[model samples]
Target chain A: MITPGAALSKSAPLLACIGLLCAWQVASLALQTESFPTALEAIRAVPSILGDKESLVNIGASIRRMAIGLSLAVLFAIPLGLLMGRIKGVASFFNPLLMIIYPVPKAALMPIIMLWMGVGDMSKTLVIFLGVSLPIIYHSFQGGKAVEEKMLWSGAAMGLSAPQRMLRIVLPAALPEILTGCRTGLVLALITMVTSEMIARQSGAGNILFNALDMAQYDTVFAMIIIIGAMGILFDAAFEKLRGWLVRWSKPQHDMPLSFS
Target chain B: MKVVSLRSDVQAEPAALPGVAPAMAMIHIDHVSQRFQTSGRQSHLALSDINLTIEDGAFVSILGPSGCGKSTLLYIVGGFVQPSDGAAKVKGKVITGPGPDRGPVFQEFALFPWKNVLGNVMYGLRQQGVKKTDAEAKSRKLLEMVGLKGYENFYPKELSGGMKQRVAIARTLAYNPAVLLMDEPFGALDAHTRTRLQNDLLTIWERDRKTVLFVTHSVEEAVFLSDKVVVMTRSPGSIKVVVDIDLPRPRKRAELLLDPRYQKYVVDIEKLIDDTGEDEIHA
Candidate 1:
């Protein structure tokens, strides 16, 4: 829960970031390891990574794919999830198949998917899509199932047809929960993106980290790690902000992030 | 001056009752029986042969204990639930499903949490294909009538329980439904808010006098607001008695609270309910 001081709550994240870096700087200096660069050294190398046009393009492509994958999953999953939640027959039909697929690592499907779809963006995007879809579907399902019966009845009385009720009533009513799923899915999307790129040795931020490590460019390695870490933090923060606004109507049940990560 | 009586027969005319009524009734529920499959093939009867005729521009309340299926009866009329046996008709036609002709205000308020008060009120009008400007104008008027004028931009969650119910009533009224099916609309509020809303409801109802089917457990509330009170019992819920209020119109709560006739009606209805063995069971 946020305290009474609005300023303190707003600046809490920035303060935490600085505090983490100060700790990292102190620990690296004390350990005195060659491979483990100090926080400042990695910070200095960050410019070179961003300044390089190829690196920027690679990271940009990674983001574009991530955005597309997340959007597609959200579009597909929410409706399916709501249907599953509301209808017993639909739920039963899909439950067994989902159960079988849920346990398998979505990123691990990269190698097999690459074999089938070739080493294109399709395989990578598909993996990310798979990674995020489950959480969104699960959350939307729960949200739809928990909608008040009387709300639908009110909608019915207002001359809303079955489909209209699902859209106007169920969709908005389940939005808070659905947004929670999307937030979790966003975190999963980033994770799956990096992990899949690492496995496939693709041209992404993940590939840059490994390539730098192989060449013994410790600063670049740490710098790449910092960039990816920053991306994750920035993306998560931005998403959390949007989620908060979208679900401002909801009684903020959990102040802490119950992320899939 | 008691025109209505408690007849000995529990079941009303079933044969030819569904269709023969060329009656001027606004809403007619004939021989409606609702049975629920309560776990492992055990079917529990919720409502049994509830034949109710609500005339146009009349205020009727179904008074019963919790789980007596009073709300269920309201839902049947609202066309949200299909009765296991029989049909609810609104103005001579069978209620196949919910329509704009019968609007419902639920106990939970059931206001869209996402939408602000204005948006919620405008929903029915928009659904009915009214132009946006016209819907907005009508919704604003309805909001003012419900006594939540400046609070239109606030979401349902931001409002008090009373305010939320007011918004719900406004939302339902915006559609201009001939029959207002209120299923314990004021039951969730405190006594003070309840009385305030009851007074406000009568003021609003007086203007148009829409046929309202209000369901509640409060005897005083039923007696105060209703033209006729249908006292019901649980465990095979059925209408135990239908008491005609016969009170003068435009009823004022302050005067009615002190009136001997009003007190007697409340007492008589309470006794009827107490005799059903539900007071102990539910309370």
Candidate 2:
């Protein structure tokens, strides 16, 4: 159904991305340096990277750590944030603690976390959890707090109990903000995961890249970097799609543009 | 100044038909007063010693100037606000909090943005333990009653102000509340739409008579929609007069415009507001 003009506009971003890749390839060729692999060299290195069993192990481990850490953080943070936002007593107790902890650079806690838990998956996961949970909690709190007063009154007048109103009205109204929080938290989780991996015993993509760079395996380093970048793009796209599906009801009110990342 | 007695003229005729018993009082506001703390060490009273009785099946409007506590009075009756003194009783039982037995329609058209017309209407029914299928059926019927038959699937944001208010009315009625408390339900609409909704509200009210306590700033709207209009003074509002509209049933806007009795009632209510000399009441 798309006309030529419509198709051109739809494909414009993809075409621009292709153009940028071609320019990178040309620059790599002109430089003729071993450290900076050309796009072709990096793409060719993918087979050997896949052939190496350690690559799969590292990718699997990283994915598992991300899943575990992010899951635990979301499970605890969302409810705590909602409670703090909706209940005066809960907010009074948690507000000071949240304010103090939220601004502290979470990445700076990695050493302390490692000292407490040792250089194990627990430390890495804790680091990721710490980095990710604060943003989600803060955003969810704001989301829950910002539900319109008249909306609450309507819920009350409809004879809904407090719990029912919280579940059916407040939570749904806060979904868009919570989803935004989750998106931001996902990026933080990945960053903390890589940092923890690089600092700890070598298993994830972060360790693989460092190992390749130390050994002067320029092609492998470039390949690992490209793979991590692709993973980040993929996760961002997936979350954006999830957001669209979850919050289609609020599309009219949410004026924010759809972001690529 | 002494509060004028406008009800005397209508009550003198004793207009109840022969075979019908007198209507029972549904909502009783007994010496209610509300005070709000504006800032540190200062408080403003909204309603002062307000007393009124809404008979069962009667459509009554509380007409006043803006910030005159008419809405506060409605909120107290609906159990959303507690009076600093006295209380509001529904069917002789003191209201402690909001319940399914009384529904409120707000001027802001408080339809849930996430819920479409059908879902919004079914919300109260669902809360009251009705099954999903039954709630849907009841919601469909109510939407039809409010002239939103085809818009059941449309979200509140997609609807015009009038249509949204229609959906809000349908949502409130779906729960089958014994009394409907409306606070300027048509206040946000255009003049044309407001007139149309007033007529539609009358039609709907006639079919199923629930005791209604409507609050508004419009003199004409109050006269057009109610069996009685209670006028209140500005700031720390108290009832100035209760004017009875004894116009015949099934009244049309055009026909009522020409009726001398309707004109007399409108002017009398307007004069009540004018006598206060604060602000002119809107149409």
Candidate 3:
């Protein structure tokens, strides 16, 4: 059973969110600008935004793109990471390439991708893929490389074959690091998904936000910002739950004792 | 000139005789020496001119002060390290690398943390391609033998220090190695746990009769577990004495503690160890 404090902690973020919304409402009212909608106006627009089929369709499209790109990134990253991790020569050969390419903004490649793929869904998907793949690959590689020598020796001494050792011992030991990488990659994928839509596509959450901004629908723009924030939080929560399940064995046994005054 | 040459050849014959019948030696440490070379420094000698024989099915303990290469010698026997000068052989076969034939129990109870107690015991058998049903049956039997029957499904983290060592021993013995190398396997346990494990180890060794080469700093432990305790001198270590343990089998802990002979062996070894003053040299 989860502790009472943990349950309370989960909702603390929502409370802070509400407090921010109230503060924004007060400030917007004081400013009295049409460009900055009050919190009440944004809240009133939420139902309309939910009722709008186009906005829902755009959200769906963005999620679909993210799912496809992230799936492809994981598929490619796992094997590449394992290879680079297991073989020193391969790691050395690819190290410079990854280091050179990983840091350059994936958005910077959108124009080139557009030129190649004609500004279609393909180009946006490619941008998200590029942004997500590197971190995943790098983290998995580091994780696999970090397997302790003694653990490997233990496997070897037990007469485990190379393949068995890698699969049973090395992979599980490296899993925590891989999950961390996945978490980071997932956040990057979300950011890049929005950026790709804003720059290249015309049918996603980014497009809706852009349209709302153009029409000076400040309340709708505020609604879009809230949706984006919710999406980020939702994805993070899901990834964390999966990670916790996968690495339950890796956690330390002792929990800190409660102190009462 | 012919008479003088004949006399010299006859005198040199004894030296060559030792090399001719090397196979008869169960474990041959043939002038073996190990050196470690670090960057920008002279090579350090860990072991030097160490020559000894361990008879078949003999229980031997290598007792020495810290940095005396006691553990290094055990590693060499286990085929985990190579000798810089000569060679170590088991039953006339040269020690090249680690194999299932030689099982080693580490001090840290290096059972894989992910596996349950039974799984860890069965690991060696599984690796050797034993069928699951048979391996499981065998593992269960071994676990029962180690007094860990009910706790088979528990992971290493859940077990006590003594229990973990039992699992480690069971894992090593699952391979049915001809020789067992234990490097201070009870060093980390509490006094009570250490004594309990020592007794358990003796029980297991009595039943199996496998050649055991145990390394430890404790003189009493060396005397208690060994058929012969080979006392070693410190730094660039060499065998100083081999004291025979004449105590009978199925010896209880209390009896050994009270026995005058056991006490003498412990005191003698401790005195010899203290006389070396080699601990300061290593420091």
- Every candidate's fraction of true contacts kept comes to 0.87, 0.66, 0.34
Candidate 2 structure quality by residue, lDDT tens digits, B87-120: 7788888888888788989999877888889999
Write one digit per residue (lDDT tens) for candidate 2, span A1-261: 999999997888789778877887999999999898888788799778878898988977887898789999999888888877788899999889988988887767877887898887898888888888998898889989988866787788777788888888888888888888898888788888888888885588788888888999998998887888778778878888888888877854454454563
* lDDT tens digits by residue: candidate 1, B2-105: 11223323333222212224325787777788999998989999998887877777788898889899999988888788889877778877777888898989
Q: Residue A234 error for model 1, in Å?
A: 1.3
- Model 1 residue A42 CA deviation in Å: 1.4
Residues B1-283, candidate 3: write the lDDT tens digits: 0011111111111112121243234666777788989678888888987777777677889988888898999888877777787777888778877778778888887777778888888888988989999999999999999899999989888888899899999998997888888989998899888888889889988877788899988888888998778888866788887777878777798888999998998888788777887563210
lDDT of 3 by residue, A83-162 (tens): 68988998999899999997799999999889998777798888888899998899889988988755666677777667
Off by over 4 Å in 3: A1-11, A43-54, A76-95, A253-261, B1-26, B280-283
Worst 10 residues of 1 chain A by lDDT: A252-261
- DockQ of each candidate relative to the true complex: 0.84, 0.61, 0.44
Best by lDDT: 1
How far in Å is the alpha carbon of A225 misplaced in model 1?
A: 1.0
Q: What is the C-alpha lDDT of each candidate?
A: 0.86, 0.84, 0.81
**Chain A superposition TM-score, candidate 3:** 0.88
> What lDDT would candidate 2 get against the real structure?
0.84
